[model samples]
Target: MNSAVSFFYFLSFLTILSAVMVVVSRNPIHSVLYLILTFFTLSGHYILLNAQFLAAVNIIVYAGAIMVLFLFVIMFLNMKQDQEESKTNLTKIAATIVGGTVFVILFGAYRKTAIEPFNPQTYDSQIGMIESLGHMLFRDYLLPFELASILLLVAMVGAVLLGKREIGERHF
Candidate 1:
């Protein structure tokens, strides 16, 4: 196989493994760390797909900034590692059945769709460069981009408000 294909497989494996670790890890900190690793692996996959800008943004936004915020919240909460009791065996069985059903349905839907086969020769085109992405984001996705910034601002404000503790008597 070609080097590109080999790299893609390796990155895919790393991403999947890290994602699984994120969910399976007992400690919340370890889960967050695994999630960061998964994001980094996903960034590598984006780089392999010739999306350098996307890869850098993924690392900056998800792996760096978002993960830092998550870590801070986790630390602030000072949660302890405790053995969580399962609700019931029936509940576990039901959840497993539902999850399996959803997975099968999604897989079947994906298989039914006509996916365009990848052609390595098409890699010559600079499709995922910063300039091209900037153009599209500014022209086609400007509204959504602005909305996302607004959403993030709201979330930041909400987090601060939620974390603030009342220190004085209530005023009329």
Candidate 2:
């Protein structure tokens, strides 16, 4: 296979492995780490698809900011690893069967799509550049962008309110 195809397969394997580890790992921290790896692999895929801006945003927003917040929350909760698990063999078998079935279905769908190779001439290379992105954001998506910021501010206020200790509460 050519390097592009080989690289695609390698990234696909890494992304799948990390995603599975994220769900299967017992420790929350390990899961978070796996999630970060998954995000990185996805960013690599975005880069391969010539979406450099998306790759940068994915790394900065999800891998950096969101994962840090997740780590902080996990630490704040003071979670410790425990050995209390009760999954039976039957449950494991069923879950595996279901997961395998879904994977097969998705793979079949992907095969049917028969995606074509990238063509630079047919695509607008400038679309992914910062200037084009900024123009699109301000001209077309300005209202939605401003609303999203407002929603985020509201969420921050809500989080602060929820985290605030009650005046009448007693601590041990």
Candidate 3:
């Protein structure tokens, strides 16, 4: 098999394994770590598909912001309990180095791959940019976009209602 296929399989395996670990892990921190790994793998898949913007957004939004949100919730829930274990600095540094190495490898692979030249007859150069994305979303997919916003608004309202405390409940 070609190197591209092999790398694709490797990333797919890592994504699946990390996703499963996110569910199976007993420790909240461990599950969050696995979930972050899963996001990184998904970003790799987006890169392989030539969607660099989506890959960056996945890393920034999902792996960065959303992971922080998850960690925040976990820490909030565990505030009453003492942390049982902490890995050594050496372990943390090793993990960082390994993750960086994997990122570099994937970037190198992406760089070495040839991009298909665009044909003006069949391709729009503005295909993946933010402006085009916004235009298409607002124009062609307006109904679906509005429906998604309404759905999110409903969910947010439901969450607020569910989390609302009773009138006489003690704040603590």
TM-score of each: 0.75, 0.70, 0.56
Report the error of model 1 at residue 11, Å. 1.1
**Can you tell me which runs of candidate 1 are displaced by over 4 Å?**
76-82, 117-124, 146-172
Better of 1 and 3 by lDDT: 1
Query: For candidate 3, what is the TM-score?
Result: 0.56
Angstrom error at residue 160, model 3: 6.8
Q: Which prediction has the highest lDDT against the true structure?
A: 2
Candidate 2 vs. true structure, TM-score? 0.70
Worst 10 residues of 2 by lDDT: 78-87
Error of 2 at 128 (Å): 1.8
Cα error of candidate 3 at position 43, Å: 1.1
Q: Report the lDDT tens digits of candidate 1 across residue range 71-156.
A: 99998977666645554799989999998999999999999999778798765557799999898899999999999999999999
| Weakest ten-residue segment in model 1 by summed lDDT | 78-87
Per-residue lDDT of model 2, residues 84-130, tens digit only: 45567988999999999999999999989967787868877668767
What's the ranking of the predictions by lDDT, best on top?
Answer: 2, 1, 3
- As a whole number from 0 to 100, the lDDT of residue 142 in candidate 1 is 100
Between 1 and 3, whose TM-score is larger?
A: 1
